[model samples]
Target: MMISLSRACVLTAACTVVLTACGGSTGTGGSATPTSSVDVGKASAVTPLDSATIARAEKQGSVLLYTNADAEQMAPVTKAFEAKYSAIDVRVLNMTDPQTFQRYATETATGVRTADVVMATDAVGMLNFVSKGNVLDYSDPNLKNLPDYARLAPGVVAMSEDPVVAVYNTALIPKDKQPKDLKSLAELSKSIKGKVGTTDITNPMSFGSVSNYTAKHGDAGWKNLEVLGQNSGVESGNGNLMQKLAQGQYQAAYFVAGSVRALIEGEEAAKVLNYTYLTDGTPMLPRAVAVTKKASSPDAAKVFVNFLLSAEGQEAACAGGFTPYRDGVECAYGLPAVEAVVGADNMMLGGYLEGIVKNKPEIVTRWKSAYDR
Candidate 1:
């Protein structure tokens, strides 16, 4: 879901226009209006069968995917799926997390053509969709092979386990002073002061990562984050934060997406930028995927979800630079790589949608006070 600052603004504007045209509320206070007036309990369900599902899906002929993931990152997966299915055409629409939910809600509510499947990093947002009965609940058999955390919610499954990490300019922060954990990062922040940067906690993904870290260590974690907030400048996207770090505007950044390394450019920027998973407890944010309850191509959606969880699909995901959690799937920045540095126990899973949504206001207040911005 990494996007440049300019692209983010454009997407935000585009979403507002679409929502307005579809008569959908632009508010983020709660779930978008449900598409159907019928009780969610009585909603129709689809049970996938091997040949039957494929036969039906081929007839549907297409699956529209609305995702927060950049098209480049999802290109390989889509290509592989199309190659395998041959009959089903895959169309990906990239949007910000909030926009993904908003537009889907709007289009579906209006009975217009909309996404068959949705994927995003915001657990809280995904859960909101599930709560509103906008998500289809289909148990993919592949779930058995994944970790328990991969089952993000009743209807949602993780597409990847992306680690929240600390990235520093190697030339600026010496190896001896390189932070291995959050507490150490806070300790180092004093020396660097305003040169340290972090993600804006107002964003759901950032909030989830920070809150999960705090949950793992309790009061001590909050205290460390407070110190971090006090000393760091807040940025909106990991891409922007990493850009600033590389440009020497910030000496370091904590609670950053590990995938940011791929965005770094040039020999100078490449040589200076280095990232590490937090050892005390690195937050693994799940990139969640789910089929829509009112999906136009339910059969094709099932086929696509199954493919995404298969071995070949995991390989495609890894090729697109997403971290694959399936065992024996080798990705340079996969869960295993994070585990090697932080240990399995210290890899904090982050999909506490209820808790995060419940205390968002108070948490945001405390976070703002600490940063005083």
Candidate 2:
């Protein structure tokens, strides 16, 4: 109930409005029935589905997935599943994070549930789905392998830890001299002057993660960004930023993790371009996945979600350049595991939900003010 009011207030800019009669299913126990809103954040323990459930899911014939992840990155997982299951077809719909959530919400409200599974980078929006009782719980045995932060609430799990990174051209800045923290990055930017490149501040992935720096460290983090913003080349997207950096047009680029993943893990450019997680800590935008409350193929959703959180699926993800959530899963491009790169104290998952998402407009305004100065 509070979640609905909060979202309404944020979107409509209305103050102190009371919510009347929001509807949805209750928590994990007896999940198929609808009820009024409850404290959805409370954690509910779960167990693996029984053999009968698996048999029923196999009969469901198809599983529909809606996600924000690139189709190429998800293809391997789907292919592996098809090879094993052989009967149930996997249908994927690629949409923006907002589109994915809105479509699920619309379908749920109208009593027509199409998405059995959903994966998206909009952690805050995904949490909203949990708060509204839209998520269904499938407590797989693999949940034991994941870090606590990955399971924010009952029925929700983080699919990947997509950390922000700085990419540099090895020909210009050598591997050993790369910036390890924000302070060093600021110094490197000053040294390079106009040779520093950055993704556009207007991009959600860039702005959202950088907002963590601003929220967590306050003045110091903003000061680092302010220092780096001077005379730096700004590209509208990370791909362009990385391209310019690799071409020797820029010595370094800031906050382009996905593009850096391609350079390091997908292409032969790893020799020319290398990426680093900040010594202080990189902001992780976890791509969260969940089963819908009214999934037509509930068992298939459980099976797929379990596979994604499994060792084999995580290994495939690492091979494709995404950071796996489970401990001991091999890191992409031989980089250090997530635990080594991001300390518990340095993580921004809670900070993002508590501070950044609700006050995004003000943060963007502050960021613009600092950058323009």
Clashes of each: 0, 1
lDDT for 32 in candidate 2 is 11
lDDT of 1 by residue, 312-334 (tens): 78779977767777766656666
Give each model a TM-score.
0.84, 0.75
Task: Give all candidates' CA lDDT scores.
Answer: 0.73, 0.64
Question: Which run of 10 residues does model 1 get worst, by summed lDDT?
Answer: 26-35
lDDT of 2 by residue, 1-373 (tens): 0001111222222112222221121111211111113221222233345777668878997899997665666677788777767877889887766677788878877988579998876556776777888788766676775567777567888767777777666667766677767778888787788898876656667676677777778888888888987757877666566656756788887776542454342233544556666657567776678888889898898888877777666667765556665545554422233334555566565423564447777877876775673
Superposed model 1: Cα runs more than 4 Å off: 5-49, 264-268, 350-354
Task: Find the 10 residues in a row with the least total lDDT in model 2.
Answer: 1-10
Badly placed stretches (over 4 Å) of model 2 are: 1-48, 105-113, 131-133, 137-141, 265-267, 332-352
Report clash pairs, candidate 2: 180-279
